[model samples]
Target: MSEKKNTNHGPQKGGPMGGFGAPVEKAKDFKGTIKKLLSYFKPNLVKVILVFVMAICSTIFSIAGPKIMGKATTKLYEGVYGKIALAKLNTQKVSLEKIASMSKTPNPKVSGGLAAIKAGIAKVISETGGKIDFTYIGHILLMVIGLYLVSALFTFVQQYVMAGIAQNIVYDMREDLSTKLNKLPLKYYDSKTHGEILSRVTNDMDNISTTLQQSLTQLVSSVVTILGVIIMMLTISPILTLVAIVTLPICGIATSGFAKKSQKYFAGQQKAIGELNGHVEEIYTGHNIVRVFGREQESIEKFEKINDELYEVGWKAQFISGIVMPVMNFINNVGYVVICVVGGMFVIKKKIEIGDIQAFIQYSKQFTMPIVQTANIANILQSTVASAERVFELLEEVEEIAEDKQPKVIELPKGEVKFEHVKFGYKENVTLIEDMNLEAKPGQTVAIVGPTGAGKTTLVNLLMRFYEINDGRITVDGVDTREMTRADLRGMFGMVLQDTWLFNGTIRDNIAYGRDNATEEDIINAAKAAHADHFIRTLPEGYDTILNEEASNISQGQKQLLTIARAILANPRILILDEATSSVDTRTEIFIQKAMGNLMKGRTSFVIAHRLSTIRDADVILVMRNGSVIEQGNHDELMKKNGFYADLYNSQFSDGEDVG
Candidate 1:
């Protein structure tokens, strides 16, 4: 276990064992999954069939060579050596034949019956012109050559097909997962950890891909090869075949027992990784706070704890899985020894030839191989199923918000916005907006002012359809917001929030994000209007300057201004300014306010601000308290009422030190 101390602040390392939660205690969905997994090979069915055919051919040829050689041993022993021992019989046959023959003298050795039989066999051989017949040898060589070629060809084809299928399935899974993520609401992220989901999509999927490609293919080949070998062994000597089959139960018990320990440890390893990633993400994201609060050592201590725990889990899992291979191999070797001892006895008793014994030894290896392959395949199967369950868990996430079934398009002629007795909350039964009613006619600027958690931003979120209203209706141009497509409803407004989210792209690209096909002129004009063009031009690459993630290279004020420029480029009928000037200096705020003035012309706008001065010119100001409106009016109207809004205004604007 590596000490969890902050190890140079690099990304937490978990190469193969990165995922979340414990491994399953029992196999789930195995039957359905196997069917689905095999379906991927359906397209390559022809190639798979060819591979099986070639495997059988190779196995049969490999078995036949020794069988033929064993038969040849018996024939040679009887014909060559057996005949040499019959000298007396041959001498008697030769004397008889010589006395009987009148035309020519016969060899006295060939006179006897046994000698005559040997002479006749020798004459037949001699008639072939001393050319030894090698047809059987030629046939065996041809079979060997065919087996070699077919095995090589099929090996390539099967590997290629498996790799292709695995990659394709991985691609499809990634795409589907990504689409699901995009569709899920923002609330889903609020409850889940990013590291956990990232582990599933990347590490888990990769495990499945690698396992399916290698283990699955080898599994198929091993099964078919073992079956062919067993058939040959049975035909030759069923007793030896039975001896081979006895090794399987021992292997099954050994591997299955090891697998239980391996899975437990492996699952623990995955959980430890998720925790490590989550802690690392938190520390890095809050690095500044950790340093400011002087908690570096505390953070290091926590981090080291996770790292050390991961090491322990990893070692245990690897140790258990490692034991399986050697144990199975030992069992296989023992089986071979038993077969050898028994088969050698048979050979001495003349029950089987030496070649047959040799062939049986090879068959024993084939028989044990399938069991080994099955164990390995089972290991991979366990891992892939764990991964699949994670993937399915994500896919099964409850949808946060539903889309309109028959969404109506937003119309240009009617842009009236209204919140008619609307009620909402982030969580159920906890209302953030309760029976709230407000209206912003076309070309009117409505501002909302309140303290933190007073539901100001929550109201804006409802208008933007980021969350659903708990009660009452939100309408645009007299059409209920829920009846319109989220896209069309959102298209009616341009928003600039406090947290400026910028992708890695050029300055020109960020500004044009709202209007996809926005022209260069439109971008430049929008930037100029938002007072972002001067800073953008000062950059080394001018408008072409690319931004890193979240536009980290720029100042906070610069990012806000860029986001504002994006909204301006959108040219929406309604503008939403959410703390647009909060992170900027007074000078930048003045520039942003001026830009807002230009953008708000002829468009209904909603401004949610902590800075009280920004809302002084608003046509109407709404003060909220505890999910309901407390006061409503323009600045003067609210000031005269002398309630919460009046007190807020006095505190923010009292000695004329500009509120931000």
Candidate 2:
């Protein structure tokens, strides 16, 4: 056999940055992603509208406060103007008569205005015994305070409502994707790494949650503020409004140019993040192998490369979006300068009030502020849409070819099984298994012995429906397996693989996973039959001993025994042992073999073994090579023939070392 390189565990080879560098896509379908995202919020339609109202009311109230405050400024200025005697040089208490005589230009209006002011002051002094009337100013300040208070209340309500809505949508989306996972075909998961799938479920969902609550509401409020400010500015002076309008084109050019350039980078960032996650997950899960091979530094280097790529793209995307503010600030300064100059002229010409100019300046700031925000929000929307597109893409993946419209159920299954003219390949147009045929009679041990890459595991995968065969039929008890529900068909068989899989749970809980409703007595009996009861009793917590995250607390041999115990407890009608004793020590192999022997009694059993000594007693032996069964017979019969099986069996002991 040709030896392959040992570079499989690291980042993919022969690509930019060792394949960690992400590809760039042009014109991502943000519109479609956004439309699909809206559907998720449909269930909260009424609450969404209420949230919108809250935002609008909050913003409107706050927007109106500035105009009202401008009134207060106008009143205060006019009151001071009325009281001042600009021309009077000296006086004991300059009465209206002395000030009138001293003023040359103000004499015409001073008498009437001073009489009105004196009469108002006297009226207030008569009512409350005060020389000055502060009641009007107090009322205006109080009104402005009330408007702001209401605005604060609306803002609070908006956040509360939107938070619940966004979270619920997130929950529902996660729930849906999780449910879809169980229904998806084994091939779907086989093609995707755990980290890639997890990235979509966790990171993408969080993005949607944040953008839905913050960006969505920001978009709405900014839009409303822009429109309302425009109207207010126009009311003050259309000429100044035109001056502010000039900034729109500059903003459009900058935002559009940046958005188009940076949007792809943002999308690439999310994808790279997923790729980085996949790399981390793969390495961490196999950290033991990395240490054994002393490849820690190599792993770290690959990690740094991916991390650097992620940072590079992420920085560019964020920096490009960040430009919007400074660009708008420049635009806003120019726009405000023009509006201020024009409004100042209007005020001097007496065409607009000083109060109106003050309000318009505030309005102009308010208007451009939203324009800046809207542009910023637009860039955020691009990233958000990119994340949403990934989520929707997962949701759109073709689920396991749907179950039959009317799937049959095997109420009872016999152990007899057959595979006829089977054909399969992992990829299109590349055939792996062809014209395959096999059978296992009830109560017979069928041992499949094969060279490496001889398609033994692929055959088992096909039988279990992990992957559908390209052509041909698989049958159990003379009934086509496809006709029966996959769950019902699979429940009839138990599998103990070369790699032991025990989740984090108590010793009892992990064993009980095979048969959840099993009584304690049944569990103990199965453990005893597997010869695993002694170890269970020796543990500190006995059968209830809890396993750590990776079940690393126990020995590999012990874990294998527990799995054997589980299969025994399941009491399946058909048994499959795929190198089941591969992990166990020599002494423990005796117990595991005895247990497997008992479990296989009176059941159809298929033993896939590399050790010829282990399966010498099989009722039938099939020698396989290059995806086809080449020979089949009892051990003695195959040895007499001195064919492929004979040479394979004899080669193991060729050095007189009795290798199995």
Off by over 4 Å in 2: 1-27, 85-133, 247-349, 404-409, 655-660
The residue-by-residue lDDT of candidate 2 on 540-621, one tens digit each, is 9999999998899999989989999999999999988899999988888877888788788899988999888899889989
lDDT, candidate 1, 220-290, per-residue tens? 66776677777778877899888888888887777777777676787677677767977887888889999
- Reference-based TM-score, model 1: 0.79
Residue 425 miss distance in model 1 (angstroms): 3.9
Provide the lDDT at 306 for model 1: 81
Report residue 513 deviation for candidate 1 (angstroms). 1.5
lDDT of all predictions, in order shown? 0.75, 0.79
User: Looking at model 2, which ten-residue stretch has the lowest summed lDDT?
Assistant: 1-10
